[model samples]
Target: MYRKQLFLLSLLLMLLQTAAFAQNNKLRVEPSFWWTGMKDSNLQLMLHGNNISTMQPVFNYAGVEVKDVVKVNSPNYLFLNLNISGAKPGKFNIQLKQGNKTVHRYSYELKQRAAGSANRQGFTSSDVMYLITPDRFANGNPKNDSVKDMADKLNRNDRSGRHGGDIAGIIQNLDYIKDMGFTALWVNPVLENDQPKVSYHGYSTTDYYKVDPRFGSNEEYLELSKQAKQRDIKLVMDMVLNHIGSKHWWMDDLPTEDWLNFQDEYKTTNHRREAIQDPHASEYDYQLQTEGWFVESMPDLNQENELLATYLIQNTLWWIEYADLGGIRMDTYSYPDPEFMSEWTRRVMDEYPNFNIVGEEWSLNPAIVSYWQRGKKNYNGYVSYLPSLMDFPVQNAMVEALRDDEKSWDTGWLKLYNTLATDFLYPEPENLVVFPDNHDMDRIYTQLNQDADLTKQAIAYILTTRGIPQLYYGTEILMHNSEKGDHGIIRTDFPGGWSGDKVNAFTGKGLTKEQLDMQQYMKKLLNWRKDAKVIHTGKLTHYAPYKGVYVYFRHNGPEKVMVILNKNELPYELELEKFAPQLQGVKQTTDVISGKAYNLNQSKLALPIKAPLILELK
Candidate 1:
């Protein structure tokens, strides 16, 4: 038991030591010296000092008092955990004296502790992530919009340029987001982007260690996480390890020539994601795609370089520790060097055991996306430690189904029903991050042909089904592109983001009734799901598609939820006893969105055409 206790104490000390390195990076203190935040009055203070093999604490003539001391495991790695004595509640310079010469003086500031609340620092699969591009979202702080000498000047007038939607703007809207029932929020890369044109998207990272001053200071970000935590909202920080903005500070002074991977000129990715996981892939295709730069403006990172690897690893660890991020959404995850990428993910998992991270591998092939998931034996024998992957296979399936045939199992709407059938490919099907439309794709409502009923049904399924659900911002109102393929129009400004604006989803002002219902329905389902443990941690069982109606079940031991997705224009009567035997005892249920009653046992009720239904057994 004593040995076990020592092991835990040693582990805690190691974490403190790792964090201490970032404090100032100039300290050569002995490893034996450590501090613990344990509140027990009886604490241990292990010490190692120069010029003396051993030491003891003794009080002086001044009302100064010293606590107990204990020898620890390491001669150099000492522990310092002491009981409070006649010390005042302020900054004090404590002197460590020896026989002839006193070598150490430590300045410590002691303050009253907080109420000791628990921090919600990690996320689970049930969270629905809402992605936002800071500059494109809203401009709440215009004061810091443009700096006089900044190379990347602010351009509100420029459609592709930066509009100052600072962190302050995001903080001001957490209430609105929480009210909308989103469990997690993922903003685009908020690090400093010193790039010249089109830095507005916040993806061109200039500095990984610091938050962009154009948004707000690091302190403001911390406060945002703190506030979001109170509402049980998890913050998923978007990170890009593959590349950095060309105008980054590192460009002026690189730590090494090999800081970037095979980078010299701007080149587009081969866009052959299949080559990375294909058994018959060519070596030339692999090297050109993974090792190449996105463009002349974005330099690919050299994960193979040891120094570069450590720098990035340390930088990621710093953000997770500093902001207490719930999870990470790694942008362009497949573009990095595969082996070192595994090491980077493994180190993060080693440091944060309970945390979850998702990588964006945009592919319609289940095998391709599944290859990145943890514990998969890829075609190349590559093993990854990544926890979750975006369910792009299902996303594409959904889009194809919306456009093509719905009945045939080989393609179209049947493709979506068939895609979930391959859940065996994923290590944890429940751990995937599911979404309708994100910042890059067309809006969900638009993709569903702007049918309010279909949009509502998609929300019902995404909220109650397995995996973490990420709702794109402005999705509730069916925001879409005025033109078919313009991404800029797809990510339009939220109406009330600017002054003298008309529509505001926050207040339901000037919105159509259908739009309001869309908002309410999403908020209703998500907020209700916030407390549904069965839905969050349940085992999912899906049935094959029948006449364009898809059915699935989420069961946790005995409690279960039956979700039905009907895309047909005609209402289909499901015989409860036939097809899906699991729906046997299901009777009365409360439809999450409308609070309406549904009776499924020994009865035939017409399921709304092209809508979804969540029926919980009463």
Candidate 2:
């Protein structure tokens, strides 16, 4: 009797311990939920838990079939592939079973997609994009400045530290943005950047699905999209596919051994972007460029891993569907595997045929940048599906043209004229994104040596040039950086972003005379471009630079406009006889900026010094 009682007590204790262990373990499903009506009828769920590979998933729903169960080297992960071709929008239960006992039950849901989600229009030449770094734009919610769970806290004194800016700040200023004549808003990354330091820039992403609590919730981002659309403004999302933050959840328990490039050890990239297109390059150099990590804190993603590639591709589609994004700006476009990038863009473009995605190649060579644009017939048989690329070549030439002296053919305005002549290399030159400066570069005012007139010329050229135009925040108010090559200072806080600030650019309070004048100048130019169809889709004709003057014309049918850029210290008379083809039937011209009128019948027209003259020819 004593032996029997001991055995029963021991068995009871064992059962209790097993029950407690089961209760403590929690299962996690990536893409916790999905939607129906996706163009692709396939779905892959990554299940993570303590030794989850030991069990099998079993589910029964009409039109939903489990096609494959993939188990990687890790015992904590299982990739369940399903073909949900005809699945209805509803909820179903998935059971993880050990023998006959069910250990975990997960309720999976299939949501209904928004109507006409796939056919949404993307930002184009008809729209002007306004770029803003959310952390320095404004502070709408001070409570989230220092999240208890996130390590980085608000430090207004520290230039690199996070401020209190949130999505709510942007939502509050939609009226101001709309009033400025900007039709599209491209904000820096707002996803979760849980790094211990320097999280203000938002380049590092720790979570793929969640927005940073410091910035706001994912719902707030959705609200931004909704509110922006109401104001007739499109929202462009900045995305990074090259790497992820070291603190990402996958780093703790990797689904596969090859999930990250150089998984066994840390190796920095050589950053030899040209190696990919170099015909005589060695395989060793190419591998290091594509597979090496960006930095110690950013783990380079291995898109070659089929499972990981599918996950990333699905993640991008999810955001486009969830947030209703107008376009995408892909960062570090040349760092990833070329084949994988080709497939990535193909998948996205297939789903949304009308969507546009611009990539950041950062190469000054038009040949290098043109290689990534769609419809390019490469000599090495490389195919790309990207719709557009940042026109870095033109940007560099424009800056040099404005600052260099016109003493030689290779110097001054000739550099800009030569760069524009290279447009034949691009598949669709009009689709490229042209800008005077961006967040990564020094402000245009600072780059132009604090000369407001040269800055105005740059803005005028970008707004009138072919392709889409993007203006950085505070550019309208002549924002400049005292220290060059410093990202923190370059992206300084706006005057009216925070409370108690003396100057508010939004309200034009406490601003210098020059600052207010530039603000009005930008307002007029932007609003004028909003309705200028000739500039949007016109045939560009140019007369080579003579002395210190450069001339170009934008003409569409009967509508015509002449642009003259002068780089002289003194006003001079510009001979109009050389532009007879374009000026043929012209009688009078009105300046778009000063609203001053000029007669075009004379052979000579007076041009201002160091200023841009946009004349509406009649």
Candidate 3:
């Protein structure tokens, strides 16, 4: 018994020693960073440690030098700048010495990069982005619910509250997203919100440098990107440089007074995105609209400050390099200072040649939305490097057509048809970000007055027509806001997200066959596009609308996909021989959604009421 007690005491001592070593062995840094440069660039590192204040670490100096050591605001931090400019290339070791003691020596390898090895920024035509509000998606890890020492974690039950959906939850559901035929996933800001409550949305960032612990560590974010890339899915980061949450860490302890646009008082926005192209908009209106806070709880950022601008731009680049993300979705694109925005886009694109990004303009007018695209004849002459902007005009027209009117002049269906006719306003109409409905609004099914056929038609149009289509998560299985038509209910959790749930979308358990069919149908149509480049990169051609039916063709060279949507209840026969140009006497083709056969040249192809068909010519 004495011998057993002695062993237990020995084990306890060993654990104590290990704990002490771990605490001491930690090579800590603050305002974390990594090194990535155009060619050979300099890197400055700041590490805080005990008894290392005056210690000069030896480095292999692949053309590097320990230029200087400076004290930081915190006594524990010591900044070290390494001059990599014009330095020789070789592997190096970094070790610190304080009198007689030296830290565990660490080795780092540096090598000359080949030409054109650096990544480039720009988006492609063959990409589909799945936008997710990190907080509302899922609470995969509950341990981070109430992190102390930073922000207060309160009730998630509040509708305007934070629900603790972190980056980890998003990482967990990547497989589901990839399976759904989405090539890219956009997560709303994962940075520290630091708000006392309702930070689940993450739009109110306090610290640009720190990853919200509630979402998992920054390393976890990098892991999500790595895992997603392995699955052939690109991660698109949703960035908000316009404004921040009022409770951001910088609110009280700002890096500078100019860190925010209006630190003393709030400015309101005119919200006239059309003002950019508006001939009569006053200067005051433009200033207010672009400078105003999105809300009382949000503080506008000051892009005019060079330091703040640099910080924001650097942070974006850092995330791209660290996470290896495929794209970026900038929120409130028009609100930030236009000059800085152009510079930001240019710099980002300069780094990543093949990257893709989409900015949200949220204007229902084509003139307003088009003004933000890459090439535009703005009266102000704002040159933007942005690849694309959201097609809010088309989305608005579609919803209005399906919900409100179908008439002679400004009526139903006509709104959508006419809107498409104005596609000439856009420099590249096919490169727009086309989304039926998003987080701020009702589900597409609900917006269509629960008309499943109409919903199907809209999906078919967006997917097969032009641009890239983004669908909300629950839209596939016909989830709707039928009872009260609330957005919260519309964004209800997918049954398969939780374990032991009565319904399982993954397994099709406990769901009606109709629900299952809708899910299967969407999967079939979208997954088929993975190989359907004819529909993706094809040119679009359409004639004037006629008799409640619209026909458009997506053609590339010899490959052509004729898409027709019939809004009429009864089938309206088409004069295939006369009007169907290139498709003359064509009969056999495969249905994109159902793999059904169709004889286009035969007696008016059997189409259901408001049916949407995609015929792949044989």
Candidate 4:
């Protein structure tokens, strides 16, 4: 008995000693693993631990060479630049040694690249993206609502609090989204936002590589991509390269002094985006606009630091490869160093030539927004490789056009016509992502003052326009905010997402007649758009607004679509003579909305009052 007890004590001591050793050498490696076959032969691994910079890393693997070891000001971090040009799919141990003894051993893995990952296609004009805030969308697993380690807790009553919606919730609603005629899913950032409060928005990222535990694991995010792809729905990830949550792991022990802009101070941005392209802008204004923090809780990253830039670039690539993303919606695109952003997009596009990335410049001026597009000839010699940008000018104009009264030639639909006329500024205006409203703005329904007819007109205009269309989650149901410009209210929870809810938007339970009608109306319009090739790739020809009516045609060879927006309070007979160029041989047209036939042989066509009309020219 004594011998047995002694043996048990010895085994316990050995286990405790092993645990202690692991605890002492615990290392957090950004990009925990990598794939073997990437177009970019180089990979930068960021290692963070207790005094890890003091030790030397030793590893031996075929076709994998540690080209350089970069140590920053922090004693706990080490950046390893590896050349994996000829590396095969396998695993090897990277031993961190103190003198001759290996103090820590990290098992590094090189995964095989997914087939055709390099040439994966991105979201385009053909797709109608559904923008979802995961935390407000649904709650599939209640268990992960309030993770023990995360600072934020579940509180559905609080508009800005975490509401337990996660990856599982989105997974559960995939069918609904597919049936609704959306081909792309643009989910807000799922990265860890371990903030003490208001972390539900996901704009403040705490960890880049890991998905928030409240949302789900990184595997689940990959699963979302898989399931979305199966339904022919592309997944566009929302990324933030400008700033990070204040509680990020690196904040406690920054890798270097220049890791963050204004590292020792907190200064909010002036938000003067024009300074970037202004020829006479002062250095002070330009520096403040680019380097200042977004908010006190969000630290602006210093992309000028080569190591930090490489780290961010690698993180983006890692997510794209891991999640098999269809595209990326980079948040606050102008806030980052333009030079770094150019390089970032260049590297990403170099690896995946066909992929798309849309940046949010949030400027109402077309010239300002156009400068960031890929092929624009800027006066400042600033070149960009970015493929797409959010069409903020068009969005603003559309909203104003729908709401403004036709008191003068410059009011109402003329606003939209004039705005679109400036499309000549963009190198590829068709590639832009046009929307009625997004997560950061007032809900479209509310913006239109809850006028369902006006809302329909806005929706029809966005869908038929010459750019990729994106709609918020509840826009179809006319979801409106009681208060304007409140982000939390703008991104309210979907009615059917939560359990035991009185009204369920998903199941069409207890919805009002207007809501149901709008839902069905959007369904029919979207499905029709799904097969409308002319609307996808056609050349747009728009006529100036006449008598509170805006007319446009999308023509591709023999296929043609005529979209008419009538804001008249009474029925108006549209003179067909002006549109004869487009309706030359058309005798009759089909209403895409109501599926009714109208004879176009007459000199005039009667249009309903205050309604939008989409006619298929046959």
Candidate 5:
């Protein structure tokens, strides 16, 4: 009877201990690790556990102090305001207790930062960026195509399904990108998007701190950044601050009741971009534009929450330092609260002053795009520290000019010329990002009615025009979609990305003569622009189009280069007298493309038919 009673008591104790262990398993901490040295001394550590707010926490670590503990309305969450200004690189622990008994102990680590992390250089006008959709770029590892635990699986045939492109594929093709003379690479978001389907685009983020297993591991992403840097190529990360995937881990158990906007209702956004800048806009309309969700699948983030704001700002800084990122391309820039975005951009710039961030404000109006760029003196007295913005005006105008059938004051080439005339509205127009087309639009070739000559002219304009130039992948070999405005077809897989692909662009296996010519033309133009200092920061002077010819000069000090866009099928005589201000004292000109020589002593120069002339004068 004594032995039986003793065994029963021991079993009872074991059961109680097992229950306690299960309860502790619910505890969680974000940003699992941080660096010891940082510009800001304050660090807000968000603690999550089962009824964690009921406990008091204490830690005794040299150079680290828990200044305050904040408890919100949620019993399962706690925020620790820690001052780690004097902390050294090491590990420490904080004990959470309910009175005398210790409920849990959390271990934290601080790491040493990389060399010159704060002063890292960012993408600039001198660098031409190559934008890529990783899922459509290339597939290097077949094994990681369909991760078991991930909800989505590989289905290459499905336009929107995961097509098995991974970081390894990008690494394999780094040489191809480098040899093409692109100095910077902008990859679409690669964060964990654990949605059940259509998650390949990566905009719907499920995990903020983790890379999607379907794409690759976080370490693999770091390896990619390291390798690209070694080849003198910079990496630009795309980040979304407006919303997150509906399947996000926090959606089921949010940190706070106000974590998401319009949580009680599922109202879609008006997408009326002018609401942000409209003078007579109703408060209700502005609220609807800012507070409404982007889509049913994406829940809008409420940046007005101070805690959430700090969380996002820290998250971006962590990635910048962790991945050693060269720049950040923020998605949906104007959707968030302007005050919070201003603070966010200011904080990031404070940390890395030299680093650049290009915000996406997709309005075709120059005034709307200029409002977000830094140094714009807005009429509303709003200040923005954002360094760059996507030049949608230039992009739209260029396409219209290419598609127009006739040349007139407001048609054809003048459409583009008039669009650029508004440059005075921007404080730093040269910092804008200009491109012909991107993943979101139809390919440039398709927009030009598949005319190779017009396509070459567009490409030449994008490469030589002021501001940074970004080319979407597959543009060189003339990739286009059969149907217009189909994003899935527009972001088609690179020919050689997958296994068993008959044509290999990397090896030039089965490309047509025109495709090969386009590829070589791209290679030459890009390679030359890599060393062309005048195009990077030169003053621009353009003469009005005269008889189907539009001419412009990019000159800096003594260096001079002229670009001519001619639409006439037959050769036209261009009078040198019209460009006296730009072409004065110029004796001879050599074509940068064909190396053909021209004498300025003649009164008129014969411009080639439908040819883009990039001339270097001496």
Candidate 6:
């Protein structure tokens, strides 16, 4: 019995030693894998482990070499600069050692690139974007609604809480989206937010390399891309490069002091957008605007750090290649350092020449937005390779114009006309995203004062305008925010997204007559516009608003579409002679909405009150 006890004690000691060694050798390598034949041969691997900086990395793979090992201020982190110039698609072992004693061994993989990945086409003006808040869209998989490891659990009652929407829901509803005539799907950030509260919106990224488990797995996100592509629908990912959640794993052990902006002394951003363009703007203001934390809960990233920049760039490329994204909607474009933004855009564009990236610069001034487009000639001599920008100026103008009752120099339709006139500021004006409203603003229906006619007019304007058009989810059924600017209310649950909801938008169950009509009208407009190439890449011309009517024409070589918006309470008679330049040879026209034929050669045109007439002329 004593001999057996001694043997048991020896076994326990051996097990304890193994546990200690495992704990000491625990290592984390980011970008777990990479691809061969990339445009850039250089790859920077971020390694994190206990006292990893004290170890030497050994690579015995052919065509792969560790050019340099950089040890930062933190002993727990090591940056390995590797050159994979002639490396083929295969796996190789990288072992970390402390003076010939192997501490940890990792098998790194180099994946094969997909065919034509470098030349994938991105979303364009011809595609209509459907902006969806995933949490509010649909709950397809209830099993993942509450994850044990995730901080925020499912709370359907809380307006700002997670509501259990996952990529499975999106994959399930691709037909509904495709049938709705939206050629592109722009889902708000699906990355891991993993915060304790307010994690539904997904802006506060906790893990750059992971998809939020509460929503779905990384494989599920990739499945969405594949399924969406099969239906001829493009996927545009919303990316936040400015800041991350305070609860990020790195917060406990930062790689370096400079990995974040304003590390020690906490400072909030000034939100002075003009500082980026104001030539005489003080360096202090510029630094505050670009480097300051967005909010106390959000820690700003420091793109100025070369290692951090490389990591961010690699993360973006990995997502693009892994998920097969069609485009990227970069959040808070102007909030980052301009130099870094330029370099980031240039590098991504270099790899995928046909890919599109639209930056969000929430400035009402055209000059501020124009400065970020790829080919803009800024007076300050600043250059940006960003291909597109959110047209906030046009959106704000459209809302204000629809709400005004009277026509004036700066009010009513003139606001929209003048806003479009500023297109000269953009090198590719048609690339801008024109929208009636977005997730951040009140619904277009509410902005139009609940007037159905005005709502239809706004939709027609954006769809026919000289830019890519984006529609917020549930806009077809005229969803509203009774709380006005309340973001949570504005991004409310889609009526039929849940299983037991009273109304089902998918099936058109329990809907009012007005809602049904609006949905049908939107369906027709979008389906018709899908094949309208004139409106896609046409030349636009507008005549000044007379009385309460505004008229515009979108024309190509042989196709022409004339849009007339009558905002007056009473019917108006318009003289066709005034539009002889566009209508002289046209005799017959069809109203796209009403399906009624009109003789354009007649002396006067009769227009119904508050009706938007989109006529295709021959």
**By lDDT, who's the top model here?**
4
Give me the displacement of residue 365 in model 2, in angstroms: 0.3
Q: Compose the digit string of candidate 4's lDDT tens values, residues 1-618.
A: 999999999999999999997776698777899998898889999988789899999999999988899888988989999999988999999988999998778899999999999999999999999999999999999999999977799999998899889999999999999999999999999999999999998999999988999999999999999999999999999999999999998898888898999999888899999999999999999999999998999999999999999989999999999999999999999999999999999999999999999999999999999999999999979999999999999999999999899998689999999999999999999999999999999999998899999999999999998999999999989999998988888889999898888989998999999999999999988888999999999999999999999999999988999999999998799999989989999998888998888999999999988988899997
Residue pairs in collision within model 5: none
Q: Once superposed on the true structure, which residue ranges of model 3 sit more than 4 Å away at CA?
A: 1-31, 36-117, 120-123, 150-156, 482-490
lDDT of 6 by residue, 402-514 (tens): 88866456678888888888888899999999999899999999988888889999998999989999999999999999989898899999988888999999889998899
Least accurate stretch of 10 residues (summed lDDT) in model 4? 21-30
CA lDDT of each candidate? Answer: 0.73, 0.92, 0.74, 0.94, 0.90, 0.91
Q: What residue pairs clash in candidate 4, if any at all?
A: none
Q: What is the per-residue lDDT of model 1 for residues 1-618, given as tens digits with 9 covering 90 to 100?
A: 999999999999999987775442322222112122212222233233432224433333222345434343223323344555443345555445555544455555443333321132456866778888777666678887876656667766666767677788888888898887787889887888877777767778987767788887788888888888888788889999999998886675454557676655556778787778777889988877788888878888888876467557756765775677888999988989888889988988876667788999998888889998898877678999999999998877776766666645575557877788888898887889888888888888888788787777677767776788888888888787767666666767776676566887768899999888878778788888888788999888877777777788888877877788877787588656553466665667876656789876565667877788787764
Q: What is the lDDT of residue 226 in candidate 1?
A: 86
Q: Is candidate 2 or candidate 6 better by lDDT?
A: 2
Question: What are the clashing pairs of model 6?
Answer: none
Tell me how far candidate 5 lies from the true structure as C-alpha RMSD in angstroms. Answer: 3.1
**TM-score, every prediction:** 0.80, 0.96, 0.83, 0.97, 0.95, 0.97
Clashes per prediction? 11, 0, 14, 0, 0, 0
Q: Least accurate stretch of 10 residues (summed lDDT) in model 2?
A: 21-30
lDDT of 4 at 37: 85
Q: How many backbone clashes does candidate 5 have?
A: 0
lDDT of 5 by residue, 453-494 (tens): 989999899988889999999999999999999898999999
lDDT of 4: 0.94
Off by over 4 Å in 2: 1-24
How would the candidate models be sorted by lDDT, starting from the highest?
4, 2, 6, 5, 3, 1
Model 5, position 59, has a per-residue lDDT of: 80
Candidate 6, residue 268: Cα displacement in angstroms equals 0.3
For model 5, the run of ten residues with the poorest summed lDDT: 402-411
